[model samples]
Target: MLSAIREIGRLVVEQVINPAQSSGGKIITIVLDEANAALQEVGIEDFDPEKANRYLHTDRGSKGNAPAPFAPLTEAKKTLNKIRTWLSGCEKVIPKTAADCDLVNTINRALGLDDPILKAVDAAAGLLQKKDRKFLTVKLEGGKTFLGDYEVFRKAVAYFADRKAEKSCSTGCACSICGKIQEKVSARTLVYGFDTDDKPGFIAGGFDKTQNWRNIPVCSECRTFLTQGRKFIDSRLNFKFYGLNHCLIPQLLVGNADVLEDIINILSDSHKSVSLRHRIKRRLTDDENEILEFLSGSKDNMTLNFLFLQKSKSAERITLLIEDVFPSRIRAIFEARDHVDSVFSETYNFGKIRTFFSKSDPEKRSNDLNKYFLEIVDAVFRGKWIDFSFLTRFHMDVIRRGLVKDEYFAFRVGSVNLTV
Candidate 1:
């Protein structure tokens, strides 16, 4: 799964860094110049995803003041403080003689507690909340935006990547990821929310914290790819299954990136349609828009990896991992599901099975039975065998509970049992 994430990173590295390639829409830019110390609201301009790169985003940290050059106007006061911090941080990184310093100075002079730019943001707060209007950049008249400077953008990228605990850079060391001996390898290559490597106990051989990089050494280039890949997975590939979260990662069987690209497009939001049964019955124009059908369409070129994640206030937990699921297996599951639906004369779905293990309030946290439910789901997807007795106990519990109240429980139980 980690290897597949690195591959995805390689695919999206360019798009993640280059604003023009990754994003579209207009930005409500604030222009500052010699004549305009209070700032001027220049009309919206095209969004450049590459321009934001590492400069504008706050992905590494959760705190409000986590050092970012630009911020979206989501919250007025918070955005102002972040912009102030970003300018201060930029001043420390950029040399006095650098061209970026002059642009930064122009922004510093114009911004204040009672600036016109704030008023502009307040007026456009509704528009600013929109997806395309998420980014707000400070630019000088006839000069580039603060994030548009390649030098400062590079610095921001390095800043976030090096925010790791390890500082001892290695030279001519073998990268644990790609297995290549590189001149420079970074210890901070791992993505956030995947694992907890803070404690020395988690380190290999329980060595010093600084030597943690030796456990999973990765080259700088590969690090960038992984970061971008993680972003892609978070934004596009991630989905909610029942009450749990899962990332649908496409892995190529033959090392063809095009196949990955095709899967991505097929699963994209623009290509998505109604539910599978509805689309099939209605005869939708784009039959391949449904996820199950498209996934089943690919027989040999690729497979899928489902990473089920549960997030809390502190960290994310991996509850289940169903890997290397072939298209044939997906087709088989759907075929069985269709047959069961036909026999029952009522629409049957995964939710019905999930309900047996659910609490009265499904939104509540999972209890002991939740693990069993996930295990059953995994077994169904992987075609793994489950002990008959082990399954019967849960079925018996459901039937016992239904006897108390649910009048139509017999039909519900029968449908789920046959479908499973």
Candidate 2:
């Protein structure tokens, strides 16, 4: 798993650093929606100098409620202090371009401000009575202003990235994935599919004083690569099937862009064509064949993996249902689905089969629905026959639901007759 993640990270960095791509660093900044609202309250069409300065510098109290004059000022001071640290450190790492110089000057200017920016921050803190403090974002206008525009911010982020990569890892153990002896296997470098949650401990290991990132046994370079790869997959190669199942197709390519495009098209077609709304079920089999043909073109050389994830109720972590399935195996699994569809099609339409198997009632659906799907998927991939009892149960459910229409009922009866 560590190796796979590292490979993905390498791919991401390759794509990102590609001269054609426009990928860059990201920074967090506060959005002052309440301050804007406060300005608009006084029929100020355009922000006055004092209001604009205040809006740019400070945020509403952390809770969004109007607090004492010092509350927002304190927050503003914290943000400025962090920016100052970044500015000071960034000078050593980043080349001093004109924009970089301007950004540095802006930060220095804000730091030195006593009356307008700072004083307005205090006044804005006192005036804001609403509890609608906006989120910290890189997407807002004022935030962009604080960062001296997106291009400069991107440079700054790139500088930070370089600095982070150059830092030494603390752990000297050989990387489990690369088998390289190196220092600096920090957990801060590694990226997980989901955010680390300490409450239920979804991150899989303790991040305490005694046991740190050393437990993972991944080096800093590998960790950075994997993190980038995860981000790229999350942004680009991820998709949904049945709107309920989240799937990620991470491809290991040897510069075969055509094959990659074909795989993406195949997956997209499968997603669109196999839905319950689609009546011509046989088309799905054809689509599966198209995918199979694409996979076979590689002759088992290309590696394609799938990850199916489910979000936890608290939305803190994703529970993986299926991880790292090969494209060839996925093709076989779909072939099994095609076979199952054929068997049911003789009696009922494909839609009915889907309806029967798929969880329709969110309230009453078994928690084991994903487990059942995983079982079927595994069975299909392995070319093992689905248990006869499973079909028997489906037949029983159909009878109990009074869904046994004429031809369908006859087919069910014939199936039972053959089994008996």
Candidate 3:
């Protein structure tokens, strides 16, 4: 077994990583880490199945060596994978606290806030309230997005109130969400963040950037609010909020792939980077377009709205991700990944929401949520999924009831092509 473990690392190094002629630079790094870590954990102070198992002493006796080299590979591979999962988090490449702090200092200095910004943040006790954040917005403008740590948001109304923007308050202070303009705290105290994709206002389902603030961009107003709001907690972290820029177009496009070159180009904008994936696969294919032209016998008029998943619903998509990194095993990786609350993926977390009984409000501090709804009409049409082939009436009705009113599941009646 010990020798088998050794062989596992060797094979992985030789077959999976080293032998791959087209391996990317990023993949090579992961492979190296896995191999080194796996080899270190597997010790050779035990039986040498490759040499002579008889030379080794077990509880039973000196068992003869296994003849075949690859015989133990199956078990070896499985054990190696388990060991790798355990060790991956032990040596994370990314540091704790999510983003870099020095950048914030530089930005604050550049903003010409002087030290008063720091004093104001300390007055507001920013550090004390830093962890009190609820919802965050992953907003981007064209190719530029604002990914930063903001204690609070300065609503458009507030900016107008400060007369900072020098523009009329389209929405006045009285009608505003409380008189929070002076304090710079948004009435919508976000406990989490809005997983805004590329489009600024509209958030998609499934694909949300849950990366550190260094990965998400933030607008100037947000940073100012954070820089000032820290006074709510402590003055020290007034300049703590800083903006970051990231390009995740490659991973997104690969996972949510389509045949259209134009679409891909639009997504991977060399001119403008757009970081957002779709909820379903609705790319127009040549065959489908041909079918449409043939069926309608018209080419002049073709309208496709291209349905995008709602931000709330999209908060639940987790199917597509990059292949290179051990994204799941990274320390606090789950936090960076938009959370899932659907029954199907809820188990991915700590089984927190998997209760036998339903709750009136079972939401949590996470990005994705599966707001299940009851669908009596659809239940009647499709019946239910029972035996491999047949659908019994009793079983069908039982399944139908489950779909309806079950917050764990969501969907009415439509073909959803999700890339899992």
Best by TM-score: 1
> How does candidate 1 score on lDDT?
0.64
TM-scores for all candidates: the values are 0.80, 0.53, 0.15
Candidate ranking under lDDT, highest first, comes to 1, 2, 3
- For TM-score, candidate 1 versus 3, the one ahead is 1
Off by over 4 Å in 3: 1-395, 398-420
How far out, in Å, is residue 375 in model 3?
A: 16
Report lDDT (CA) for all predictions: 0.64, 0.44, 0.23
Name model 1 segments beyond 4 Å from true.
14-28, 34-38, 42-55, 58-63, 95-103, 112-120, 123-135, 142-146, 165-169, 188-190, 205-207, 272-290, 338-348, 360-368
Worst 10 residues of 3 by lDDT: 23-32
Off by over 4 Å in 2: 16-169, 188-190, 193-209, 251-297, 312-327, 330-354, 360-368, 402-420
**lDDT (Cα, tens digit) per residue for candidate 2, span 1-420:** 446556656754564321111122112233322222111111102222232223322221222332211122235555444544555655665566886665555544444543444344444455544443322221123332334344554555544543432333355667666888876454434355343334335333353423334445556567657656555455444644433444355455466645554444444443543542243333322122223334433434346555666655433244444444466675664565556546655432223334445553435745335555456545544556888788567556645554534334655454443332
| Candidate whose lDDT is highest | 1
1-420, model 3: which lDDT tens digit per residue?
A: 111112222322333211111111100001111111111111112222222211111111111222211111222333223223322322232133333233222222222422432233233333233333211111112212222112211121133223322221222222121222332222211111233234533422233322212122333344333322221112110111011111121121133222222332332232322122222122112121111111122121221111112224224332222222221223222332224324234223111211211232336343222221112111211333323222233223333565776733333111111101
Q: Which ten residues in a row have the lowest lDDT in candidate 2?
A: 36-45
